[model samples]
Target: MREWLGWLDHIESVEDSLNNIKARIKAFADNGGYPESFAIIYNGEIAGTVGFNDVNKFNRIGVVGYWLGEKFQGNGIMTKAFESLIEYGFRELGLNRIEVSAAIDNKKSRALPEKLGFTQEGERRQAEWLYDRFVDHAFYGLLAEEWHSDNRED
Candidate 1:
């Protein structure tokens, strides 16, 4: 996790994890769920989380972010979770565009958006500083029209 999540690099105790959860909850409340997050539960345990961040209601855009536990990988959990999240983003949240980015080297992470029919927008050079070094990100985007057209039932 530390290899991908830089914030975990400094978490030395359980309290730090709890504090982070607290902060996420507070942010959800304070922002009226603009940055809504959901836990990915598998076998009654939290596999990970998926969320929308940097939401702009006026612009009808948001960024999707997610992480899955190692054990939860390859189980199709994140894909299903993303399917639901994207549905909600388009149908309920009324978003026109939803973007996602993954570290360019992280193939597993990058595969999700690609598999879900998101268009490869571009690359963000040195988009994130992960502890010791910087990491580039490959950006992907899905617009409401695109998603709807691709997902429509015949």
Candidate 2:
């Protein structure tokens, strides 16, 4: 896990994640915007994380981001977690739109938003500096109206 996540060296350590959690919670409480992040727990273990980021209360929009441990892939865990977060972003947070971006070469990550019915908005060149080089990102977006219409229970 450490080796694979080396690209996220900016995080430095677990303590960084904890501090980020507290900051995000505080930002939400005070401004009604900011990511509502959570650990992805499965079977009493931490599998990964999923959350909404870059929340804009005035514009009613946010970006979604998530990751799952390699061991937990192919189990539909992230999809379920993302779906719940999407619902929360729209229904609970009153957000109008949610976007997701993944490294263009990361097929697995890129497939998630598509599987969840988010439209591929476009690609951004050199959107992320992974480790040594920049990586492009494929963007996807979904609107509250679109989500509700597609997910309406019969």
Candidate 3:
């Protein structure tokens, strides 16, 4: 609750998501989907969160999402978090692919995928209706085989 509240105070969309967390978790469980979520802790304090929502079992895919505390930004922490999530998605979850979408203007979010070598599939024009306007989004994806090969030494 404290983590949600802290994020809520500063992030408008996060504030809205806070209201749906409980019900969303319940729904995810009911649908046989694991709402893989975790909080980043440093010095025993919460620094950020990362998670997947609306996971589809048939397709073996999930949408990635995350946020970091302002103090933790631009330090490669979020990249580590994303790498952890992707590792879990491919290995533990037995997923074939992971997808992410970010507003075109969200440079940090968009850069994270490219940094991890995710292919930018395409842009969805006006796909996200956030902050009371339709904003374009860039979609990126990383395949399980790609991740697996990247880790192989031989």
Best by the TM-score measure: 1
Error of 2 at 120 (Å): 0.4
- The C-alpha RMSD in Å for every predicted model, in order, reads 2.1, 2.5, 4.8
Residue lDDT tens for model 3, 44-141: 88898887865777999978878888888887888888898998888778789999988788887789999998999999998855544677889999
Error of 1 at 10 (Å): 3.4
- lDDT of model 2, residue 21: 75
Candidate 1 vs candidate 3: the TM-score winner is: 1
How does candidate 3 score on lDDT?
0.79
* Predicted structure 3, TM vs. truth: 0.80
Residue 11 in model 1: shift from native, Å?
Answer: 3.0
**lDDT of candidate 2 over 57-106, digit per residue (tens):** 78999888788998999999998999889888888889999999888888
Models sorted by TM-score, best on top? 1, 2, 3
Model 3 residue 28 distance off true place after TM-score fit, in angstroms: 6.8
Cα error of candidate 1 at position 35, Å: 7.0
Alpha-carbon local distance difference test for all models: 0.88, 0.83, 0.79
Q: How many residue pairs clash in each candidate?
A: 0, 0, 0
Q: What tens-digit string does per-residue lDDT give for candidate 1 at 71-100?
A: 989989999999999988888788999999
Runs of candidate 1 with Cα error greater than 4 angstroms are: 31-35
